[model samples]
Target: MYYSREVAHQIEKLRKGFPVISVIGPRQSGKTTFLQHYFKHYSYFNLENPQTRDLIEQDPQQFITLNPKNIIIDEVQRLPDLLSYIQVHVDKQQEMGSIVISGSQNLLISEKISQSLAGRAAYQNIFPFSLSELQMHGLALPGHLDQMLKGFYPAVYTREIEPNEFYNQYIVTYVDRDARLIKNIQNLSQFQKFMRLLAGRVGQIVNISSLANDTGVAPNTAEDWISILEASYIVYRLHPYYKNIGKRLIKSPKVYFYDTGLLCALLNVVEPQELATHFLIGGIFENFIISEFKKELSARGLPVPLYFYRDQQGREIDLIFESKTKLIPVEIKSSSTFNRTFFDAFTYWRKNIQAEISGYVIYSGLDSQKVGEDNLLAWNKLDTLIDHL
Candidate 1:
């Protein structure tokens, strides 16, 4: 139904100030769709087309001259050389909203843009649909407890496609194409294996050596591959937050897939029913909700310094939001029911930190309630919390 995205306003703001705006995300995250919907009058070109690529490669200056102003260049990474010409044109013209570029491979596109159009461009990452956007279109699920389990991919939500077939094709076509072709990885088989292993280890602390062991590759190779995945928006590595606390917090980062649907696809999770019984259901659910929260924060142009609280003494909080000199701790439970034990970690965190501590238990329940002085919020209410922030 074409629900409006939070990035629309950001893009509009950037258009008023910058000559170029680059929208980067993984393939099929709706980058093209978004730009087409927003910039209807802008001339469009997909560099993936051989004729278009050849025209740009043959003479970038002429290509720029043909479409002088307000052009939308789709898959710009396919012709990285054209960015240099674009930079020169934007610098000479000094016209705001002159160009918009979209691509899936951030490693190539971002690096070229940095070198060519460093201060001349604004960048944004376009993730899949958010809960608020879905709600705006009146597509809110009646019982959204299963939302985190199945995740919110655009095609999955809009079409009546079988989850298994949809996800299977997504892995085979988009993920595989981007990982091997766009990233230029030599070991396709090993890369696929690495992805599947990472899916199983979602929401866990990053351990490259352990991943290397599991993937039967060198530690350095595993680390480099993870970077490629992160650069391409296939995965995200959330660093731990520690300022002056003397006690040793986790120095390592946690890994999460940008889209939980892709993660479930890698794990062969077909539907919500299958996800509920899966062994990694809890971890997957945690990853889903946390990633969506991060997306919400980014949509509002806020820094997401999200982390988990874990001590050597066996106490842990699943997600921690450190803002305005306070610690907001959250625990995510895949269970539809709540228990008193969920507050134990919150109690420990409150006792230790001098900062004001508030706790929330985000569960797969229909109704939101208070559990012994702590707030218990439903998964659907996540957008409300973000708005209140």
Candidate 2:
């Protein structure tokens, strides 16, 4: 079954301008599906097959010669050197949207693309399915716990696989197979522990020393593994907003998993019911909301990136979306009960930043009330604020 992706619109728009479009994201992010669905007329190549990779390695020019002028290359990073040949082929072709390439690793694709196809290609990151995307596919959003347990991965829904079983195999395959493409892990057990440690800290400030201590590895090892994880689309770090240079604030970046279901697996969350009273329920809930906001902005062609705000006094704002002229503050709470206290961070934001600020509170509760400046939103309607911003 083919499902619609919101980011496809942006890819379609970019296709009209760039000669080479590179789609990079985690494995199973539907990069191939999106490209082939939209660009059905182009010739497609899957470099993962041993024979196809061998053929390309044997004679790059010959392989290029036999393929159609417009082509789709999957897992292009498997042959990074072939990008130069792709560049030459793209340079000679005057047509826009002549070639599309998809890769799993950003660290591999971005550097090679910057080197060989700098001005020749436009890159796009394809994360897992979003809430709206799933809804569009005829699957209504389940309760918060179910969402956290099942996650936003397309396969989990489509294949109807058991979340616990799927994630178990996913971790093993990702670590034993995909992770090696970046760096060799001497001890897979330690790597797994490192993941759990990071997962435990989702929606909290990233602390390398403590994480290393907990995982029983050197901080440097943890750092390297974190990089590999980020490049592999397992997790991301949100930088703190420091627009007020003179204000003393916490400089640490908060950690988040790209998919909450994976985080659940790491934390040994076997069932959705466990998530309700789970100690990290707040963190997991915030993770889902923050990632939803991030995806919305990225898919909408927004120029700004996501940031957070905090001061030495321990005051914190969950998310800050900044543009050339505006600062948007979003606060998240996991409690079902709504209170006036949730607005404290936004209140602090309003006072500290002289610029225009839009405020929103995404709470687990369904009830909503308008504070003086902040608009309370049910968790279901997070995209409403995200779309407008």
Candidate 3:
């Protein structure tokens, strides 16, 4: 059974305008299944097959002849050299939706696309699964601990698989495999340590030197590993929202994992209830809220950027969603109790900022109400807030 994906709408629209449409994301984000399901009318080719890959890499002419036009190429990053030939055929034919390519790594596909395909292809990134889509899949309103530990991955919900075992294999299959594919690593154990430590730092500002020291690797290796993780969609770094706020600011970006399940796997919590008393519960909650907001924006084709607010005086806001006219500030809390203090940061910003801004507090509480200038939202009501924002 296939649940719906919001990115399908964006891809359908892009197919009409561009000759090539590419979807790039982390492994198991359903890039291959989603595209194949949508474009069943098009010829299918899997470059991961040795025979097909050999033809494409060793004999480009024969590969081109075999795949004439209107084809869907799976794992095209496995053989990016074929993109030049694709570019030529699309230009000569001048047909919209002549080729659709899906790859797990953004590093190779994006660079090759710009160098070869240029204006001929349109691209978008697909995340694991959004809360809204999970709801559509008949999942219940998960407890705070359950949500954090289980995450929003599609396979976990669809197949009813154990999240712990699934994420364990996920790390071995994608994280370890991708690192080997990217660079020559003398120690696989050290590389795994780098990822585990990085996951421990989710929702916190990154320190490359500290990470390297603890992982027993050099700073340059840590930097390169961070790039590889981002390129493969395993992590995202949220830039600080900086403006003249009458205080000096820290520009170091906060790191967040794409799926909380994978982060928890590295953290080694076996059960969902463990998240309740876990040391990083608050950080995990913050990560979940921010990632949920990201999926909403990506689904609607919104290009707005997300930012975090922190000042030299120690004041902070968890998320800042910016648009052309108004800036929306959101504070995330793991406690189910609704507290007035959550509005402190938003209230301060409302008074200081001279432009249009809206304030919101999203907590695990069941009650939803309006305070003086800000609105308090229950966790389950997040989908409605996405509509308004």
Candidate 4:
């Protein structure tokens, strides 16, 4: 079952103007499936296949000559040099959507694309299913805990794989294969430990030295591992929104997993009900909300202008969505019961900024209403907030 993707429209729009369209995202995020299904008429080729890779390496010109236009290349980063050839052909042919390429290893693909394809290629980031996407298919869960545990990974839906079982294999495959491919790590077990510790600190500021001590690795190694994770789209770092507010602000960034199901797997939370009393439930909930917002922006091919607000005085906001003209402050809470006290942070933030702002408090409660200048939104109605942004 193909749950129609929101990014498909953006990619099609890009195909109309660019010669090469680059689809970049994490492994198993459905890049291959989505491209194959959407561009079915295009000649498909997977460089992962040894036979195809050897033939391309044996005679690059012949490969380009044979499949001159309307080509979809999977895992094109496996042969970065081929992008140069594709660029040459497209430049001379002066054709739109002449070649489409997708890759999971973003660091490699991005570097190669910048060097070879450059302006000729347009990019679409494919993350796991968004809440809106799931809602369209009626696969979205009503409760926050159930949704967090189930996650938004396509395999969890398409293959009907249990969340725990799927993420367990996901971590192993990521550490054993993708992690190594991104950078050489001598100790895979230690890297796995680092990931677990990182997962435990989701939605909190990252301390590389502390993480290194916990994992028994150097701080540099810990930083490098984080980069590898970010490049592979396993995790995302949300930086602090800085302004001269006459108070000291925390500079370090907070890290969150792209998928809550993977976060649950690392934290060893098997059942959705178990999260009811779990110690990390609040952080997990926060991570889920932030990731959903990210997926929403990525689906529309918009820049993620998300940041967290925290200072030395302990004043903080869960998320700060910055646009060119105004900044939107958002606070995330896991409590099902609504409370006016959730607006305390918003009150402090508004006083510091000169701009008049309408704030939002996103909680697990079902009731969504306007409270004075602020909006009390249910977690499921996040799309409403996104739409206004």
Tens digit per residue, CA lDDT, model 3, 261-314: 888999998786787788888888889888888877887778888989877787
- Please give, for residues 1-389, the per-residue lDDT of candidate 4 as tens digits: 77789999899899999989999998888898899899988999999898999999898989999999988999887888998888889889989987889999889899999988889999889998988899989999988888999898899998857889999999999999888888888899999999999999988888889999999989998989999999999998988888753321447889999999999999999887888789988999999999999999988877748988877787889999987778999999999998899998877877886449999999989999999899999999989988887
Model 2's TM-score against the true structure: 0.95
* Cα RMSD (angstroms) for every candidate in the order listed: 2.4, 2.0, 2.3, 2.0
Task: Give one digit per residue, the lDDT tens place, for model 2 in 63-170.
Answer: 877874779989998999999998898788757888888999889889999999998898888888888777677674557778878888778878968877788778
Tens digits of per-residue lDDT for model 1 on 15-41? 899999999987777788889999999
Q: On TM-score, who's better, 1 or 3?
A: 3
lDDT of 2: 0.83
Q: Itemize residue pairs with steric clashes in candidate 3.
A: none
Stretches off by above 4 angstroms in model 2 are 244-250
Query: Where is the poorest 10-residue window by lDDT in model 3?
Result: 242-251
Between prediction 1 and prediction 2, which has the larger TM-score? 2
TM-score for each of the candidates: 0.92, 0.95, 0.95, 0.97
lDDT of 3: 0.83
Against the true structure, whose lDDT is highest? 4
